[model samples]
Target: MLASQFSSRHPSTVALDTGLSLMRVAAPIIAILLVQDLFSREFDRKLHLTSLTYPRPRYQFLLGRITAIATLLLFLLIILASLLAVLTTWISYGYTQATPPDLGLPYVITVVFIALDLLVVLAIGTFIAVTSTTPSFVLIGTIGFTLVARSYSGIVALLTRDSTLVGNADTYQSSLSLLGYLLPDLAALDVRMISLYGDWQFLPDDWPLRVVSTLAYAAALFALSVWALNRKKFS
Candidate 1:
């Protein structure tokens, strides 16, 4: 169900395009190099040259290889994010929008939140992949969840704006307003807005609420996902 939206698109998983320029460009090259040299050399040199490998043993080796790659990926994400943050700071130094790296405790919080988000996503993908016995299901589900979240955010923001949402002081209007306030409003934490905009375009005041909200929501989602995975029994 989660992946339905992703599969709906023809040629689904052409994810050959999404990501930061440096990562999007460098990742595949790096992966190929690593796999060809390290993975292939280790496995092929050991198995084909060393001995015959069985399916179970092959999966074990592949799983170990994936763990190493995932670790590398985590570090890659950290470095990439740190580089972007540094570059943004360097470019925007002395500008009005320049907030210190420690500004309002958002950096650490965001990093932790994003890490947790990544774990939840990977967990969801792994669980679904294992249970469904189809890699596409996991791929599509993760992509679909992201797409659905984006769509839901857009509609909620459009409907809750002052003109449409808080139009009148009627009871129903107040309730609608309160509901908007309570629902997980994600548009607030859009970090891209800060990175793309010129310095001084926005203040901490403009985005702090979003950071807090996203962190809170991320925690809840992660907890729920973990609980679900723990309870799920695969046949």
Candidate 2:
């Protein structure tokens, strides 16, 4: 399928490409669908009041739920990586008589990026769930925001290019600068090229910055969701 498109002469590339293929198509969708009802269901069924009456603070409860989801996803990702490892070995044998492929630090870092991306999506989904009154609205908002966040940079790039051709680059470039600061550039975190080329030069060297930015963005969303939940009245 889509994974075959990323297949390369290198076993490492095959493993990484397969993993990215799965993540590209499935990660955000799975993360959103999993967390879309996190808080909305509570509001819909009138369970938020009961949950708020617990001994712990509100943020702690939210953190617990988020942590639980993250842990579950971690387990699933581990299984996925392990399967890819086995597949890489099989592919390696077919391509070369070398020993089982040894995935290097790059693959490890790529896995971290994939996990972080999922967490970012989860945080956005949680925020939508917390703010929305109905599960349907939560699902819609989460999907909408995910699509916007993922493509915002590309959309701005297109606008800036068009504006330049029209001799009005300043207007669009300024707006694009403002938007670049406001929205998380999820594209910056894409390391699929590294997996495809099996080399560091294939991807941006400053990828760590992207990972840090995403972490900060996810933290902000979690804080906002907690704040919103605290301000809300269960009645």
The candidate that wins on lDDT is 2
Cα TM-score of candidate 2: 0.81
> Cα lDDT for residue 20, model 2?
67
Q: Summarize candidate 2's per-residue lDDT along 1-235 as a digit string, tens digits.
A: 3343354445555565666667655767766666755566767888777878889889997888888878878888878877776666555664652222336666667777778878788888898888876788766787776676777687667766576564566776676667677778776666756545556775676777887889999999999999998897766
> Model 2, stretches more than 4 Å misplaced?
1-18, 96-102, 155-177
Give the range where candidate 2 is weakest over 10 consecutive residues by summed lDDT. 94-103
Q: Tell me each candidate's TM-score.
A: 0.43, 0.81
What residue pairs clash in candidate 2, if any at all?
A: none
How does each model score on lDDT?
0.43, 0.72
lDDT of 2 at 37: 52
> Which residue pairs clash in candidate 1?
3-141, 97-200
How do the residues 15-121 of candidate 1 rate in per-residue lDDT, one tens digit apiece? 11122334433543343344344333443344433322344443444345546755775797678666655554443343333222332234444444344444334
Compute the lDDT of residue 35 as modeled in candidate 1.
37
